[model samples]
Target: MSNAARQQSSRTGLLAGFVLAALFMLSLFVGVIDVPFHRALADAGALELLLISRLPRTLAALLAGSGLAIAGLIMQTLTRNSYVEPSTAGTAQSAELGVLLVTLLWPSANLFAKSIVATATALLGTSVFLMTAHRLPPTQPFLVPLFGIVYGGVIGAAVTFVAWQADLLQYLSVWTNGDFSGVLRGRYELLWIGAAMLVAAWMIADRLTIMALGRDASIGLGIDYARMLQLGLVIVSVISALSTVVVGMIPFVGLVVPNIVSRLMGDNLRGTLPVVAMSGAILVLGCDILGRLIRYPYEIPVGTVMGCVGGIIFLWLLFRRPAHA
Candidate 1:
């Protein structure tokens, strides 16, 4: 809070931004086609690939990471739980269900309408998880995420059942794992909705901090805790649903990124918002680049890459804590 501290914070902020920007630029050039500056300058085809494919893929990764990271922060703050996130807490499953349901019923709805359904289902799903978490007695440290995973699996099974009956399993498979290969210029514009949610998250971070204090204190301080919680859930729904709808599922981003940020930067959401967003973007973008390079032209999905990496990290995080059961 002092001037020197503020200056130090600013410097750290700048350094993080510089790192993220550098990584982001590296991401734009690492895909199937290597767009060297000179080659792109000389060849219209290379230039077109840069503008259409490379640029959109890069933007999609960044937005998905940033949005999911902030959404993780919001979920953790609202629930007062470190383990809960869109993927584990049933939000992703709910959103996927919504997408599938819409696809089945309307069969011809536009992308935006399907996005609406996805967001709605995600909201319902996350609300159920929060309610369950509220009712259940807190026990072991590992139990919460375990419960979340099981809860999500049940919902996911329902989704799979519907997909199976209709013989749309392959279609459903796309949303379960995320990849940027299909993200062309026109197709990936929906990811901007997630970016917008991130901006809104920054604006409301203080209120979220206050609400996290506990329902009674937040109300005593004249903060509408319920409304804040609602807003937070809606933001989470939009980010998770939109990202899943646009880029499939990128797991553990909300869970892993926010915890890492909190460890490094403390629990002040307002102070750490940019760093959280940057870290999220960096993690996903970095993984996406790794996914592409691992097998060359046969690219693995970013969600699958994150799942493998994040699962290991999650196990380490679980056991690393002395109190975990």
Candidate 2:
């Protein structure tokens, strides 16, 4: 990159960092109960609330958003399609299925066990999508994500049917609806694993960028294509599962954030990955804060908020000029 471009990227990163930090502080204070920043340190109950609820919830949003966004970037890179993401590409639905099965069979299963099963199912589902997506004409990139949506819908239907039969629709709802209301300090630590996965992704960003060049090109360049594919699958699946297992399915963070970042920053994964992560954090965290204040004490789920926001953005992406994209 030229010095000017590097300077521009640095400034962008600094600006995004500032926005994210400001949003995090805003999130800490935006709830039904006013936990004044000044008194929070002095008041034991206020400090406890911040520690137990507000801080964890904010961090969970940050982790879930950034992780899923990175997962989306990886999926897009591996598939060479900008439209596919964990939620739209059957990965999140598969994770939800895994969580549902474990809940039914192993009622006493721990969060780790549930996440393990969910990750496995997500891996399988995403692999299936990749195979089928490859079969569709590469000339039509839109079909890949469309097929994934339908594919995910079928899996989601199966999950719903099973949940209905087992009289666990409520559990299904909890897993489907992404909210941080129930996130406490202990409940949300699973997401830190997703943070670790983010680090792993950054380390391999260049390999992933090469892998995006298609199998033949990557092979010619001495890349282990299959191994890299598997690694990417694991990263995507694990992040999807962790997010679902903890805060439910957050849509569009994965889909929209990556696309927006790509349009603005271009597809140098090494340069854009941090911005993607930070942008995702800001989007989801801001949405969560909005949900908290929109109805006051009666909060909307972040999933609902994202569905509205993400749907509009997805439409805009579809209709906008290819030149802009």
Candidate 3:
């Protein structure tokens, strides 16, 4: 990394850390049942609320954000496309389909079973996307995820058809509309899978960086390109699945956070990974806090706010492409 890049990364890291801390504190104190920040430390009940409720929710946000950012980084690097992400590429949607299947086939499925099915389905969907993209000529790499969107829509329609036929539309709706309010003690434990994914991502960061140079180049360098791609797809699938299972479908965090970090800090995964993770954490937590504040006692889902802001940002990026190009 250049000295300037190092400095920028450090600055971003500090800012992200500060934002995460503030989010933690805010989540603990600010809720429908307001616990005064000053008094919460001393009051047992307030401390219990902080420890049991807000702390877990905050942790879930951090883990999910970081995990999804890492997933996006890997996908972009593997595909050599800035626009690609788990959400855009049908991984999350496939996961949702998996959840829907489990719920319909066996309504009493455990969280771990649901997550496993989701992960497997996500891996399959991502593999199909990669295979399809590989066969296409390299005219516009950005269009790959657009293909994924169509693919996702098709699979999503199938899911919807089955769901409607089974009269489980309400159950399916939960997976479509992301919500963090349901995160608490027993329920929020599912986010630990995201923590595991974060560790796995860091461990394989070097291999991913090498593979990002393209298949021919990576093979020339004696790296197993196919295996590397499979590993990366697995990571992306598992992380996206877990996040969707926990918080529902959060579309643009994977795309937007990693792209922002790559532009600011450059595209090396090792260097930008931490910044991407932190930025994602800050973004989600900030959005969640904003959602709470905007509606006051009646909180808005974090997913709703992200979708609104992300849509505007996506449009802005679309219009600004010519200038950047």
Candidate 4:
């Protein structure tokens, strides 16, 4: 709350914004098409490509990356678990199951309908994870995410079994990997829902901060602990569901980016939210661009790249941190 702290937070936020903007520009340039930026200004074909493909792709990446990261931070704070996030905590897998079910039963359901089902499933799955974690002793901090992985695996296995039986394994497979290649104009509008949730989260950041101080503490502080916690979890669930429904599952943007931002900016969600969101967007955009250029045409999925990178980062966090974490 001091002047120096405010200035530091401002600078960190500004830096994140700069990085996000630069990456967005780079993302527009790095694509399958070989249009020069100079020519795109005047040429019809190039201009159209920029508007239809590149603009949408950039927005999708921005939304997916930032949304998941904010979701992770919210879960971490709510549960007081450093490792809990959409991917590790089974929220994304749960959403994936919802998508699979809708595809199998309805077969012709629109994206909004699928997203609705996916969001409900995700909320249920995340609530189960939190309840299970809540029942365990506080001594074991890592057990929460470990249980999440097992819980998610079981849910994922059930989904896989159904997909195999129904001969929709390929459809299920496509949603698990995160790629921006399919992000055309009409396809990616669902992601804006995720963006809206982040704004909602910012609006209630202070209440969530109070809720994070343990139920007893929040209650003693005259906060409606249960209501606020549920609201926060709902927001997280919606973000997880919409991101999965819109662009498939992109892992580690939630886990890695939020952790890094927390380390740099401290635990104040108000100060760190924008930075965390921006860092997530910047990191994903960088990875997306790398995926595009690495093979010159046939691009790697952004989820795969983030998975590999995030796995290493996760290992480092697992090994290098002190026992107190």
Candidate 5:
């Protein structure tokens, strides 16, 4: 990396950090109750609201964003496809199905238990996708996520069937819509697990980058491609599942953030992960803030906003494929 490139990366990182910070402040104060910054400082209720509600929600958004972004990066790298994401790959839907199962079966499962179930299901779903894909003749890399979308649709249909049978369709709707209004102190803390996963991903970023090169090449280089890939999938599953539990089914943070950052920073996982993480945090926070502002006194869910915007962005990326190829 040249000094100019380093300086440019530093500037981008700093700018992203500042944007994240500003958005966090906005998230804390921009709710329906109109808690002024000055009053929030002195008043206990306001302080409690800030600490319990706004702080946790903001933190959850940050973690969810960064975690999903890193997961997307890992997935894209592992599959060698920019379009693959947890949502696209049926992992998020599988996690939701897990949550629904736990809720229906136990009816009293704690948030931690629910998250565990979701994470396990997500991991299972990802493994199934990988195993199934391994059997098919190699095709376009994009086919992986396209297959995942079909797989997710199948799982989602099962969820709908079960929900209908159990008369819990309304409950399922809540899970699918991706609302952050449910985020509270104890409940939202589960998302911090995603923050921890991001740290773990950073530690193994170099190995992941190597593994992305192809199994034979990675093995020849003395790297255990299978283990590294499994570890990355586990991390991605856990992050995706936990985020789904906290914020419902957010779709494109993983897809969009990592793709954009990789384009800017190059595909080196070690250098790109932080930039992806920061970009994800900024995107989620900004979207959440927009959701809060656009429908004053009755906010739209951040997930809905992301889904709508992300769909458009996805289409744009799809149509604007590389010309030189």
Candidate 6:
């Protein structure tokens, strides 16, 4: 990039960092309870509430949002399709299915076990998706994401059917709808694993960027294509699984955030990944805050708010073609 463009990108990142900081502060003070910052610092009970509930909820939102957005960017890079993400692809549904299976079979399983199973299943499901999507004509770019949606629906239906038989439909509902309302300090620490995966992605960012050039070209460029492919799948699957297991499946943050960041900053993953992560954090945290206020004393799930908002953005992206196209 030219120095001018790099300077502009730096300015944008700095501004976004400020916005994220503001939102983070706002989140701490926005719940139904009136725990003023000063009061929380002064009173032990108020401080406990802030630390145990509010802090964890906001941090979970930040981790899940940024992690899933990076996962989506990796998915797009691997598939060479902009529209696909964990929710639209089979990744999130597969993770849910894994959690359900573990719950049914080992009713006494721990969170770690469930996360492992979910990540494994997510990796499998995503692999299947890529294999099938690869068969579709690239000329018709829309076909890949459409197929992914149908594929995910099939897995989700299986989850629903099993849950229905086991009288665990409520479990299915909770897993399918993302919400941070139940987050507490101990419960949400698992999402930090997603943060670790984000670091892993950054370490291999250049390899991922090259891998996006297609298998033959990437191999010619000295990238171990198959190994990089597995690495990407592992990162995407683990993040999808952790987020789904911890807070349920929050959709569209992945799909929407990366696309917007890519549009503004261009597709060099090394340069753009931070912006994507920050944008995702801002979007999800903002939506979570909106969900809280829109209902006042009650609350809507973040998934519901994103479904409404992200759905509109997705539609706009679908019809908005480039001048070259």
TM-scores vs. true structure, each candidate: 0.94, 0.97, 0.95, 0.96, 0.95, 0.97
Candidate 1 per-residue C-alpha lDDT over 107-211 given as tens digits, one digit per residue, 9 for 90 to 100: 999889989999999999998887777566655646766778999999999999999999999998789899888899998898898888888899997788887
Candidate 5 local lDDT, 16-110, one digit each (tens): 88888888888899887779988988999999998888888888888888888898898888787778899888888899899999999999988
| CA deviation > 4 Å runs, candidate 4 | 320-325
Give the lDDT of residue 57 in candidate 3. Answer: 85
Query: What lDDT would candidate 4 get against the real structure?
Result: 0.87
Model 3 Cα lDDT, one tens digit per residue, 1-325: 6888778878878887887788777776778888886888899998898888888888888888888888988888888888888887888889999988888888899888999999999999889988987776679875787887888888888888989999989887677777788888788687787778778888877778888778888899888888888888888999999988878888788888887777667777777788888888887887788888897998888889888877777677666654344
**Model 1: CA > 4 A from native:** 1-8, 138-143, 319-325
In order, candidate lDDTs are: 0.86, 0.91, 0.83, 0.87, 0.85, 0.92
- Model 6, residue 306: C-alpha shift (Å): 0.7
**Which residue pairs show collisions in model 2?**
none
Collision count for each candidate, in order: 0, 0, 0, 0, 0, 0
10 residues in a row with least lDDT, candidate 6: 316-325
What's model 4's TM-score? 0.96
RMSD of 4: 1.5
Q: List the residue pairs that clash in candidate 3.
A: none
Encode model 4's per-residue lDDT on 225-251: one tens digit a residue. Answer: 878878888999999899888888888
